[model samples]
Target: MKILITGGAGFIGSHFAVKMLKEQHEIAIIDNLHPYYSVDRKKQHLEVIKEAGDFQFYQTNLLDRDETINIIKEISPEAIVHLAALPGVAYSILRPLEYIDYDVKATVNVLEGAGMAGVKQVIFASSSSVYGMMKNVPFREEMAAGKPISPYAASKYAAESFCHVYGHLYGMNVKILRFFTVYGPWGRPDMAIANFIKKLKNNEEITIFGQGGSRDYTYVGDIVNGMGLALKNLKQSAIINIGSGRPISMDQLLDELRVYYPDMKIRTEKNRAGDVDRTWADISLARELLDYEPEVDFSKGIAETVAWAEQHEDFL
Candidate 1:
């Protein structure tokens, strides 16, 4: 199948692109190569995908309607995986309008373009942060996500709503997957796991927010696999959680890191606003709908990520 993946040079999207390419699917990637992190990292991801010899890439932004529409018309892809967005809770707090412009408006453009191009399916990248501070142990898809504490979460929720509208009004098959705290190779450096690992490797103090708050740290490989399954099993518009069905505290994660690197240090700090105290996903719906199950356990995934960081010590 020929597919278009937006933000395919970023962390999770890049991993998904590689996985899909290995499955012999033709891929066209669209990424602006934003300066959120090192552009060099994005270039490296592109190089890895180029080795596959069947992937095409476009350096563009979804906000430019003409460019995005033209690319879609030319590629005539059967499906789209929309992953491009300004994605950071703290960053959203600092720059709310940027978040709204990129996450919300860009999504609207994508949906409209896809509809005009007669695309069959779309898989959206949502976030567990949309659940806010739920009292439940594992968040369910049917639960209310109306109380988004941050601009980032609000934009994602708005994007999901746009997808739903497109699905209902135009009969588009849409799947909205809410990802938990995903980590692993090619992970975003701004995320907790990657930042902590980088700090530890450099013998710097890793900051702990809210005295070791817990999170459902899903691995990137597991997320990409589940996304592929969701794309394959799309029947109607749906919202699902993609996560390891368990939560791990920051203290526990730090201790595990110590086992790998005994000299690791931690510094406690207050939790930022709009940050959830904890997140655990109820993945039963995903299992039933997409046959999705997280394969890489937290400890194993962290170890693998640490090994990768060690090998690329200069980047740390």
Candidate 2:
């Protein structure tokens, strides 16, 4: 199957692209190589993808409607994986309009472009943050996501809505996957696990917010696998949570990290606004619908991530 993956140079997208390519799927990628992270890292991801074969790659922003539409028309992909977005909740707080422009508007453009091009299926990247501060222990797809605290979460929820509208209007097959905190090797440096590993390796102080908030740190490999499963079962419009369904507190994570890096140091700080205290996913729907189950546990995933960080210290 011919597949188009947006943001295919970023952390999760890059991993997914490599996995799909290894399965011998014809792949086309679109990424802007934004300054959000090291362009060198993005280039490295592209180099890895090139090893599979000379696949299609376009250095274009999703906001460019003409360019995006033209690319879709040319590729005529059987499936479209929309992973491009302005992702950081805190950053969105500082630049709400930028988040709106890239996360919300750009998503609409993808949906519209896909619809016009008669793309069969779309797998969107949503976030667990959209659940906000839910009293529920494990969040479900049916729960109200209208209480998104940050601009980033709001934009993602809006994009999910747009996907539904496109699905209903144009008979487009859409699958919305609300990803939990994904961490692993080749992870984004800005993410907590990666940043903490980097800081600890350098003997620098790592900040802990809210004295140990919790998250369901899903591994990138597991996520990409779940994405593949979701794509296979893309029969209709649906929203599914992709996670380990296990919650690990920050203190627990730090303790595990200390085991890996005995000299690791951390400083406590107040939790930032728009940040949730905890997040655990009810992945039963994902398992039932997409046959998706997380294969890597937290401890193993963190250890692998730490090993990768140690080997690639120069990149940090």
Model 1 weakest 10-residue run by lDDT: 307-316
Q: What RMSD does each model have against the real structure?
A: 1.0, 0.9
> Poorest 10 consecutive residues of model 2 by lDDT?
46-55
Task: Kindly report which residue stretches of model 1 are placed more than 4 angstroms away from their true locations once superposed.
Answer: none
What are the TM-scores, per candidate, against the unseen true structure? 0.98, 0.98
Model 2 agreement with the true structure over 1-316: per-residue lDDT tens digits = 8999999988999889989989989999999998888999989889878887768999999999999998999999999999998889889999999999999999998999999999999999999999988998899988955999999999999989999999887799999999999999888888899999998888899998876689999999999999999888759889999999999998899888989789877788888999989999999999999888899988899989988888888676
Clash list (residue pairs), candidate 2: none
Number of clashes in every candidate structure?
0, 0
The model with the greatest lDDT is: 2
lDDT value, residue 289 of candidate 2: 90
* Per-residue alpha-carbon lDDT of candidate 1 for residues 1-316, written as tens digits (9 for 90 to 100): 8999999999998888988989999999999998878989999888878776578889998899988988888888999999999898999999999988899888888888888889999899999989888997889988855988899999999889999998776688988999999999877889988898888777889887786679999999999999999888768779999999999987788888888779877777888898988999999999999988889988899988988898876554
Q: What Cα-based lDDT does every candidate model obtain?
A: 0.88, 0.91
